[model samples]
Target: MSWLQLKIDTTKAQAPVLEELLETLGAAAVLMEDSADQPLLEPPPGATPLWDATRVIGIFTVDSEMDAIIEFLEAQLGEQLPAHRVEVLEDKDWVRAWMDHYHPMRFGDRLWVVPSWTPPPQPDAVNLLLDPGLAFGTGTHPTTALCMEWLDSLDLQGKTVIDYGCGSGILAVAALLLGAKEAWCVDNDPQALTATRNNAEHNGVGERVHVFMPDDMPDMQADVIVANILAGPLAMLAPVMAAHSHASTHIALSGIIRPQVDELREVYGEWFDMDGLAIKEDWCRLSGTRRA
Candidate 1:
């Protein structure tokens, strides 16, 4: 069946309200994208980030009266609605369409993030088969790539790893594939926990990776710790991360822009000897060892 798609370009501040208006106006589904093609970096914990200029698209039945709906929208939204367009959309394999944009990505050497549908580019390398979902961290972002590259350089065999703020469990699973004896995947969001679990199962490392919420995380020292959360939370999580690390623990942190590196180094320096920063585009990763 064909669907009527209504698209409206608006500011980030108005996008949420327009989505609600679309729902109230009988929209079956609504999606939002960046109108300016700006990439949204990872937000602080508990925050949902959006682009400055957002394009909202709502779908409805093609049989619906669009003129009357447009009139209602005009009344409710007025000048705030900006401009809109309506088009007919024929159903197709949306999952395939989305997956088409994602290809196998390699990090460092011998580590690959392969979409579940695609064959690994390097069969001899360690490949992580993943499906993108509600959770973040598919290795596409520089933050995730930095963490994976750090993980690749480590000797993880027989080590205990902690993937703090584990989104999609990609890092934890990668550590396992790299020979970590076990990994703990911790995140505050339930969807993140679910996504991590699902991805771990997909990689056949579910048994080796344990999932938890921050409040429920086990108290134990880990040989390695990796967190790709933003700088704000990383600053706040310093004590928590330190408490979970011993003098020998190796730590890697990402999701930091260049300007934030100095502050992060200062914050983590209390418990770790912060190493020199690694740059990927505008993003940076900080590696350090726990202080004795």
Candidate 2:
């Protein structure tokens, strides 16, 4: 099926607001990319990080009835935005575009986020396959790396873990591989549940990994909670995730930019005494133990 790939070009400053505005329209997928960040740039000797001056956000899968889409966005910020600003591009290969580029990637030591089409890592890494459809959680992103790295450092022996928003079941499957006794993964998307199930079986942990739909959790507290969701959900879930802990339970959180560390910390600070944190490429991972 063909999808409409609408490129709403805005200044770096106007991009976020526009992107958020597009969400109220009909965006199946939305993303912001820096125009100045050259895809063709080469590494340089002791060079400064590249600065992005322009912003491009893509909104996908709209119908011929984009009048509503246009009206909704324009209604809110029509005067502020550039005239004739919405440029709709046709996506002839939307599926292939994501599949071709979103390949398996390694997040940290002994952990491999293998894509569905790619062959598993050769011989030595802890392999975790993923199929990220519309949902989230692939280990290639730095936020996922932070959580995986935190999981790598811990001794998951005999622990029961909960992976909230278990997109692809990456964390839950990894927990079992890292020696957790068992894991339960929860997601609202049936597609994600299916992928999680498939990935668990692929990783040889299906028998040990239980998949649950949202609001249907098994009512048992876990020894560890790993949430790789965005900051908004992570903060909203702070109490619920913490509730999954007693005294000795561990927590690993990611999907937050470095600038927002303090907000996430404040959410879980009183409940957990932080163990340590990892920073890589502007993403942060935080882990802690729930206090008694």
Candidate 3:
């Protein structure tokens, strides 16, 4: 299907207004990119809070109703956004174009990212199938990999786990296969639940992995809580996730860049003791036990 790519040009001061407005319009994916900087998993290193001009590109799937949606959004944001700057294109080849650039990535001692189209290697390594599609959290991404690496090193023998925002269910499935007794996964997206279920089955842990939609989260707690999601949501969900964590429970978090660590840490610090944090490339992951 074609998509309305709303490319908004704005000063640093106006970016947040545009961002908030776009979300109000229900943008499927809104990515703000620097005029000169390349795409990144996280904000660039030493990147100031809002230092430069940028193109806030918002992608919305276009259908028969999409024209109206675009018109409505244009009218809603036109005064604040440059309407002429919008670009309309058929995004059929977008993900395929990215597939070439992301063949397969290996993380730590175990965990190999084998795309759905490729056969998993028979390495002693843990095989993770990732076809992130649109919901994010592919095991190949640096942030996700960092979390998987931490899971690989943990002593998960017979432990219970909760994987919030469990895109593709890679972490929870890995925990079960790696020695955890069982796991529960929470995601608001039905597509992610399907993807997570499929990935768990592919890894031979489907039955043991419990999937939960946002409103239907299980009240049960666990020995560990893992979420590979953006820093904003991670901080907001810390209390709910930490409720499932005991004093000895390990909490693992990802999808945060280097700069956002302090803010995120401060949020989770109320319950979790941030003893060790890991960074790879522009992404970072934090791991710690709950404070007794």
Candidate 4:
């Protein structure tokens, strides 16, 4: 079925009201875009952030009465929208559209995170079968890439690994596939747990990849710990991670921007002799061994 897409430019204050109006007009879906090229990053939990100037779009069945819909909206709003346009939208597979945008991405020389729908370019590479979903760590971000490179360089045969703040269980699953004996995956989000489990199962490593919340994490220490979390939580997790590490344990830390490196270095310095760092596009991955 075709859709009637109506886009209107409006102030932030009016966007919600217009969206409601569009819903009443029998819109199947409503989308909002920023008129200004502004980004909404790290919004407060459960809060919906909008731009100062927003472009609201309403999608309706092509057969709907567009004239009556516009007339009702204008009468209820008491003023016409600054700008508006209606266009016929041919039906397309949105899932395929999303998949086309995310091709198989390689990290380091050996590892590749390939979407389930796309074939790996390098057939001989150690490919990780993954699907981009609610969880993070898709291998597109520099932070996750840095960690993957470090993992590829490691000799993890028969080693036990710990993935703190494990999003999608990418690191843990990758470690298991790279010959690690087992991996303990920890995350606070329930969605993350589900994502991790599904991804692990998809990769045939579910049995070896154990998922947990921070509070329910195992008491056992690991041979290596890989944490790809922000600097604040990384710093706060210092002692907790240290308690889960031995003097011989190797730690790889990412999700750090260049400017935050020195602070993290000082914080983790108390427990590990942090290596210089692996720099990639303003992001840094720090690796080191636990202190004796």
Best by TM-score: 1
CA lDDT for candidate 1: 0.85
lDDT by residue for model 4 over 1-292, one digit each (tens)? 6788898888878987998899888897776767762222222222235567788878888788988889899999998866999987777532344465578887776888888777888988888999765467677778888888899999999999999988778899888888899999998876578879999999998999889999999799999999988888899999999999998899999988888899999998998999859988888898999988
Over 158-219, each residue of candidate 1 has an lDDT whose tens digit, in order, gives 99999998988899999999999999989988768987999999999999989999999989
**Poorest lDDT segment (10 consecutive residues) of candidate 1:** 37-46
Off by over 4 Å in 3: 1-101, 116-122, 131-134
Give the TM-scores of the predictions, in the order they appear.
0.73, 0.62, 0.63, 0.71
For residues 205-252, what per-residue lDDT tens digits would candidate 3 score against the true structure?
Answer: 888888989779867879988888788888888888777777778898
> What RMSD, rounded to one decimal, does every model reach?
6.1, 9.7, 8.4, 7.1
Residue 139, model 2: lDDT of 67
- Best by lDDT, which number? 1
How would you order the candidates by lDDT, starting with the best?
A: 1, 4, 3, 2
Could you tell me how far off, in angstroms, the CA of residue 128 lies in candidate 4 after the best superposition?
A: 0.6
Pairs that collide, model 1: none
Looking at model 4, how many pairs of residues clash? Answer: 0
Which parts of model 4 have CA positions greater than 4 angstroms off? 1-91
Could you tell me the lDDT of residue 171 within candidate 2? 84
Question: Clashing residue pairs in candidate 2, if any?
Answer: none
Positional deviation of 41 in candidate 2, in angstroms? 22
What C-alpha lDDT values do all the predictions have? 0.85, 0.70, 0.73, 0.82
